[model samples]
Target: MNYTAMLHTHTLAWFLMLILFIVTVILLKSGKAKGGKIVQMTLRLFYIFVLVTGATLLIWNFYWATGVKAILAVALIFTMEQLSTGIKKDTLQGSRPMVLWTQFIILVIIVIYFGYFVA
Candidate 1:
């Protein structure tokens, strides 16, 4: 696929992933582990989509800033996965979830900046 198409796909995947992440967290918080797990599994598929598209874009256009953005994007994905798992397992002690959420948000901003403006 062309770069434009790939970029659009990547954007759409991340958008859907964000929505699914919110839903999964809400379900888990509401004591609906089964439903949350199902959504979480679906969310994982979107993660794969985002990673694949992003990787394709990077391969098509390699640059130092883009490389950094890719790394940050991966970190953002990892943070989301960890936060959801922590919520599901009830392992997030006080402030732990908050910290992860903060990291996730910051990484998102940085990644967006690099993806859009820098790169």
Candidate 2:
């Protein structure tokens, strides 16, 4: 039961991911925001905050990560890059919304799996 504030870390990670998902949905729904810079700036700041928390947790608190979980994390990062490229260019030639949600769900499953199994 000794987690060293592990519950808080998991909660933060989940909460961050949820917020990230919602922000992305908003951006997608806005359809490039019709040249509005507000959404763009908001997204930029959100990305920085997300990366800060993600990197900090990765560095400060080691997770007994499984192969599935590790791969999913890498995949999530890759997805983020693809998403950024699409957002910046306002183009999505091949990506689909469903594919992203599927990947996101898988990542969430792995996170929950790790949360319960690793500790």
Candidate 3:
């Protein structure tokens, strides 16, 4: 796809992933096991979409800012997976959820900053 199209796709994927992440956390907090499971599965797809589109955009034209953003994006994804695993293993509890979610949101903010301002 062209850069313009890829950019649009990346934005859509980013927003969708953010929304799904919020929803997943909410569902888990509310003890909606079934809904959380479904949202988790769907969230995984959006994760792939964001990664793929971001990669395409970067490979099309590489820059230091985009490189940093890409690295942080991958970190964000890995952190999210770790959070999920923690939740499943019942290791993270109490204030841990808030801490992890805050980190995730901060990562999103930094990524967006780099994507829009630095690049």
**TM-score: which candidate is best?**
1
Residue-level lDDT tens digits of model 1 in 1-119: 78899999999998999999999999999999899999999999999999999999999999999899999999999999999999999899999988999999899899988988998
Candidate 2 Cα outliers beyond 4 Å, as residue runs? 1-3, 32-71, 84-88, 95-97
Task: Estimate every model's Cα lDDT from 0 to 1.
Answer: 0.94, 0.57, 0.85
Clashes of each: 0, 0, 0
Candidate 3 lDDT by residue in tens digits, 50-91: 999998998997988888889999999877876765765568
Which ranges in model 3 have alpha carbons more than 4 Å from their true place? Answer: 93-99
Question: Cα lDDT of model 2 overall?
Answer: 0.57
Highest lDDT, which number?
Answer: 1
Cα lDDT for residue 12, candidate 2:
67
How high a TM-score does candidate 3 get?
0.89
Q: Rank the candidates by lDDT, best first.
A: 1, 3, 2
For each candidate, C-alpha RMSD in Å?
0.9, 4.6, 1.8
**Looking at model 3, which ten-residue stretch has the lowest summed lDDT?**
81-90
The 10 consecutive residues of candidate 1 with the worst lDDT sum are 107-116
